[model samples]
Target: MTPRPAKGGRAPAMSTEQRREMIVRATIPLLIEQGSSVTTRRIAQAAGIGEGTVFRVFTDKEELLDACVAEAMDPGTSLAEIRSIPLDQPLAARLTQAAEALRAHVDRIGAVMGALHATEGRSRAAGRPGTKSPDRQAGMNAATDAIAGLFAPEEDSLRLPPRQLAQLFFGLLFTSSIQESPQDIGPVVDVFLHGALASTG
Candidate 1:
């Protein structure tokens, strides 16, 4: 007979989504520690699941890795918080908060992408050898859309369209993530909100 999936000598108390999230979370440290050589066995052990259950949840190693990457990169929770920001708050305060939020999200994804590149993305991803993984691209688009929404309410005050603002904001975030010139989002947001030209009045 097929055996039950056990946890602490009892069945695991988790739904499919919860189980999948747990396994993906467990995969994070392994992906960092083991690189491309990370095995399903290790993930199963970390997740406290039977090896067969891992396959049942994810079709194969590539699929599992994709799920892990997607989960790690998803900005849903962060976006929700950004969405709930009081629209009546001062524009500088709102934008500063948004910049900090995006910075934190980018930092996390940067680390995960670094690890993934070491695992496999350094070679064949999809288009060119150095192109971003599909999951990363999707995550980027999602983040841009969410940030764009944050700017939409202030379209009347912005010199540029909300979408354009979103693009520039992301550009600043991507640039700052790689370089040491600017220490944090504070300066970036200042220039983004105030512009380079000095006040005439």
Candidate 2:
């Protein structure tokens, strides 16, 4: 017999790993609502676990914050879902679907992006160019490539250097304090993907 999914459906069983995941899930909302000044006791309370458990799993607040940042930025939406969308679909429609999926999966990605941008700016001001860890840079590279593939088969318009544009997109997503509504970001990303300056002038 096929095994049943977790309580939230498709999330697997509520093992220790699941508990850790749940705790991380709880951390973001708390961080957003309360700001980064959140204490371990508060995080544990929000996670509905004993305060000691938080320490047991994560060595300290910095470790927990790192975990929170990692989880918050991850695109929870599966690439398979995007691939399943009909190939014949119009570029606008496909792009809209992808944006919506991104919005849903990493709703808090904006916050994380903002943090990264701030760090980058500070590093630049301090004369530490591209100081982000090798691992982070690698992850950013991978995310860029994956994002680029979403615009396949429409080479003339959608095609851009994935590596370079990925840097721009990541910078824009993180640096700009744009509180764009769903409708806004769709066309904005389109213009960005297809050269707005050229179209306007």
Candidate 3:
């Protein structure tokens, strides 16, 4: 019965980081489900927070949209690890690894692909050129560098520059429709890397 404690003296809670994390966690699936029009209210509902709280955290819709897009295309795979993949292994093995990696990248950000298609339509209507973002450009650069470093034979002696080869490979990865069979990608990549017609008699 001494000091009677300091009633209501406990410090106010600090949950800013937690709130932000929750918002980010909810953003991806919502974006996936609702396309890019995902409103602040929608995000708040997904995150289980008040609509006002979303605005308190994000300055505007554009800022939040940009953040969500960035997260979607992160490429989760590390550059070093990608470089370490056995590119020099037999062509079949290399192709398998490359196919799996490409699949993984798409799986992680597959939801964005639909949005990208819509964006492309708008850009084309406006006569704008569609291109990869700086981050994606850098990723392409790193991937090509890795390919050149590993499979020197692919373009080392070939007349085409490493960059051109990189472009071809990048296009193959990004543009080919998601075929049901993985084997389909292999020959497609081959036709891309090697000519469709073979010289063998």
Which consecutive 10 residues in model 2 have the weakest lDDT in total?
121-130
- Clashes in model 1: which pairs? none
For model 3, the superposed segments whose C-alpha errors exceed 4 Å read: 1-22, 37-53, 74-81, 84-89, 103-110, 113-136, 150-165, 171-181, 192-195, 198-201
Q: Against the hidden true structure, what lDDT does model 3 obtain?
A: 0.62
- Which residue pairs collide, candidate 3? none
Write candidate 1's Cα lDDT for 16-62 as tens digits: 77777878889877876676578899899998889998988877777
RMSD of 3: 9.1
Q: Rank the candidates by lDDT, best first.
A: 1, 3, 2
Clash count in backbone of candidate 2? 0
The candidate maximizing lDDT is 1
By TM-score, the better pick of 1 and 2 is: 1
* lDDT of all predictions: 0.70, 0.60, 0.62
Candidate 2 colliding pairs: none
Report the CA-based lDDT of candidate 1 relative to the real structure: 0.70
